[model samples]
Target: MTDTHSDDVRPVQPLQPEQLGTYFALMEAVSLLQHQVEQQLRAEGDISYVQFQLLARLAHGPGPLTMTDLADGVVYSRSGLTYQAGLLEKAGLITRGPAPDDDRATLVTLTGAGRALVARVLPGHVEVSRRLLFDPLTDDDVRHLGDIMTRVRDHMRARPPRSAAPRKRQRS
Candidate 1:
């Protein structure tokens, strides 16, 4: 452990048992929720969670966005996103084309098929989401959980992994 004030290294202290238990419980909850959602998506839509996410992003956004923008927005690696895009294209769910002004950038957009898929799958998706997320929590619990997660996500966004000390954010 490094002293927060002085930066002196010391032996790291483990979390108290209760703290560890709570942490593990939170992780378990997240894993279970994700698994349930994934199962529902696969069963109902024949789409992996990642693919569904990509389609959902395109369907929800205002307009077609660049590949880089999609990659960043979806928190996916460039290569992985390229492969997923190919699958989507093959399925006639989305189209990839060159950006009109920027020859280097590829833009992605949903086709009529993709929009129809979203419209088709959304009811089951919402049902599963509500069953796993909202059904177990009170209104106040949901609000507090949302607030806490938002703060946690923002803090993580500001601080990159310690393995890669953050560089300055780049503009598109």
Candidate 2:
């Protein structure tokens, strides 16, 4: 006979010591680097890092993307996306329109001005990124890091998020 407690919920096990160390080191490095990037974006581009990411995403997309599609590509909530889109629209950087194919969906497009803003921000942005992310690593380290990151990202994304967890405001 099976033990009565077997079916009871079992807490997830903690990561092994080495795994914990690696996990935290990665998080710390990413957090520190992101902080520097945010400062650079604010000082040079006069935009928040998230705003820069938003503009870059719209600019790179084949065309206007539906809000749902855009949200899937970046880390943001549906309501939060609407607010950010409104800010860009107010700044004349992007335009939001009802999706032609899907009346229920909204589409976002990057304007010429938006394109220009992204272009202007790229030089400084790339410099800062290289300084923090790429400059310290050797060629082999770059390749290895790319592979590791790609694998990790793919593995994590393969699992759908649980209940679309809400996060606190990520930006001002």
Candidate 3:
């Protein structure tokens, strides 16, 4: 009889070299761009990437948002966003007020200083983004990349969560 634990001893299927190459290229490109932007923001302005993103989001927001709403807007985890919010609050870049409807939740708003900072940094940020991301790509390439990325994102989102059981192998 087969041992019950045999189910756990599955052979590993390696990704094809091309698939691995694509994954690495995408990751490296994103990492390098993020590092470059982070350095620029730090050197030109005294702000961490998360802090910059938080301020930028708030500046563009239609109205004040709770910490949870801000976290969702920026796709950050709630705990990390809260910590960043604290830093911004300490810097006088943002203000937290008791939510009118909900005493428990605080509404975060960009202060005048925060808005000014975003206005000051936005030109440089746009130039950097254009230089690093857009200038190199042809208009067609930009369109194609956007379309492909959207499709990939949607496809991934549509997939069901992975089961706890090991994935079954496809038969030839």
Show where candidate 1 strays beyond 4 Å.
1-13, 16-19, 159-172
Listed per candidate, the RMSD to the true structure in angstroms reads 5.7, 6.4, 8.8
Candidate 1 global lDDT: 0.85
lDDT of 1 by residue, 34-150 (tens): 798889888888888888889999999988888888877777777798999999999999999999989999999999999899888889889888998899899999999999999
The TM-score of candidate 2 is 0.86
- Pick the lDDT winner: 1
List, in order, the clash count of every candidate structure.
Answer: 0, 0, 0
**Model 2, runs deviating above 4 Å:** 1-9, 161-172
TM-score between candidate 1 and the true structure: 0.80
List ranges where model 3 is wrong by over 4 Å.
Answer: 1-14, 153-172
| Candidate 2 weakest ten by summed lDDT | 1-10
lDDT of each: 0.85, 0.83, 0.82
Q: Output the lDDT of residue 81, model 1.
A: 89
Model 1 lDDT, residue 36, Cα? 86
| Best TM-score among the predictions, by candidate number | 2
